[model samples]
Target: MDNSLRALGDRLRQLRARHGLTQEEFAQIAGIGYKFYQDIEGGRKKEIWLSTVERLAAAYGLRAWQLLMPNMPEGSKVARKVASSRVHRR
Candidate 1:
């Protein structure tokens, strides 16, 4: 499995745990099938669709970019660079 995919799955699991939700509960909240959500959190769904990312982000009241780039510390150089790049894209 790709490192990035594994990291994404790990972050997803952490977020669910932080919210004290089970996979089934999270899946329901995200409007996705339980098995499909499980595949994603298990890192079996290698190529996640943008719609799925948006759904998951919405379920957690987060931005899609935040979900895609998990664990970024606030005020960090890398985070600043990403934020600046996003602003420039607009």
Candidate 2:
């Protein structure tokens, strides 16, 4: 996979968690198939469409270009909340 795509996948995972949504929920909000979203987040997709990116950005209340930024949010409070919840669940 391209490094940029990998980075985008990482950003998507972090953003979805920070928004307090499971992958399935986020996929629904983006109006995409759950498995397709999984592929995107897993970096298995070869490419992503602009429309898809726009939908994802809208779901996160952000602009598409923001989502494409090389430096995006990471290790924030909301992300920590999601991380802790996963630990508790296990």
Candidate 3:
């Protein structure tokens, strides 16, 4: 798995916890199955869907870039790379 993906998933777990959301609650909000969310948070980033990422960002009150880039600034170099990757993937 990509290190960027690993970091993103880790940050997502922390963000979910900070919002007082359980895996069940987060899964509901993200519109993904509970087991799917569990798989992601359990350190396996193999099944994420972009639409679901959008849902998660909305639930956290953060933009997709924020969730994807974690500690990076919105328009910083790292954010640009992540955004670029996302853009090109489609």
Candidate 3, 48-70: lDDT as tens digits: 66765766566666677777874
TM-score of each: 0.74, 0.77, 0.67
The best candidate by TM-score is: 2
For candidate 2, the 10 contiguous residues with the lowest summed lDDT are 81-90
What Cα-based lDDT does every candidate model obtain? 0.67, 0.70, 0.61
Model 1 clash tally, residue pairs:
0
* Residue 57 displacement (Å), model 3: 0.9
Candidate 3: deviation at residue 89, Å? Answer: 21
Task: Tell me which residue pairs clash in candidate 2.
Answer: none
Candidate 1 weakest lDDT stretch, 10 residues: 76-85
Q: Which regions in candidate 2 have their CA more than 4 angstroms from the true location?
A: 73-90
lDDT of 2 by residue, 7-68 (tens): 88899998876778898777766666778889989999888778777667667766778888
Among all windows of ten consecutive residues in candidate 3, which has the lowest summed lDDT?
76-85
TM-score for candidate 2, residues paired by index? 0.77
